[model samples]
Target: MKEVIATHSLDEVGKHPDFGSAQATLRWMLIYMVEETAGHVGDLDTRREVLDSEKG
Candidate 1:
């Protein structure tokens, strides 16, 4: 993925039919990837807190 991104401009557009009909540029994809990763991390952290509290 990094290599592909490196070869293209940030303005380069592509389709993500699996996600939706709307097309997104490389910049948008990168931003979405970061946001999704952060959201998942937050979810895991919340789950960890719940489990730790239950252990008490």
Candidate 2:
């Protein structure tokens, strides 16, 4: 992926039919993924706290 990105330009991002403009679209996709992962992590932490409290 790094090599591919190195060879590709930001301008070439959304040129293909399925995905759209690469630069803008990929940026949003990455942001979404990060947010989603954070949410999952928060949920996991909450669950851990609850379980720990139950052990007290």
Candidate number achieving the greatest TM-score relative to the actual structure: 1
- TM-scores of the candidates are 0.76, 0.57
Q: Which 10 consecutive residues of model 2 have the lowest summed lDDT?
A: 8-17
| lDDT of candidate 2 at residue 33, scale 0 to 100 | 75
lDDT of 1 by residue, 1-56 (tens): 98989899998888775867677899998999999999999888889889887422
Off by over 4 Å in 1: 15-21, 54-56
* lDDT of every predicted structure (CA atoms): 0.86, 0.66
Total residue pair clashes for candidate 1: 0
Error of 2 at 42 (Å): 0.3
